[model samples]
Target: EMVMPGDNITMEVELIAPIAMEQGLRFAIREGGRTVGAGVVASIIA
Candidate 1:
């Protein structure tokens, strides 16, 4: 999905596959083809 500055963003994910105890999931927020923010999903429920 493409996003512009000052835009609001929302996301929801449903995990159907098993994730390992030590596994890491990464997410990146980008604008103008450049990354503005990045983080990892430390944990998820449901």
Candidate 2:
């Protein structure tokens, strides 16, 4: 559950909103209104 810098891994995430889930989709992980990390959708599970 902990990711270090420059580590590439795939994790299954649950979203609370109906947002677009597709490959190449960019996203950011925020904490305290600041971006902690960022990632892109590589593949969809369903």
Top candidate by lDDT = 2
Per-model C-alpha RMSD: 6.0, 1.3
Tens digit of lDDT per residue, candidate 1, span 1-46?
9867777655555646875533266777578999996656665655
What do the candidate models score in CA lDDT, each in turn?
A: 0.64, 0.88
Per-residue lDDT of model 2, residues 8-45, tens digit only: 98788888887867899999999999999999998888
Clashes of each: 0, 0
Weakest 10 consecutive residues, lDDT, candidate 1? 14-23
The reply for model 1, stretches above 4 Å from the true place, is 1-23
TM-score of each: 0.38, 0.77
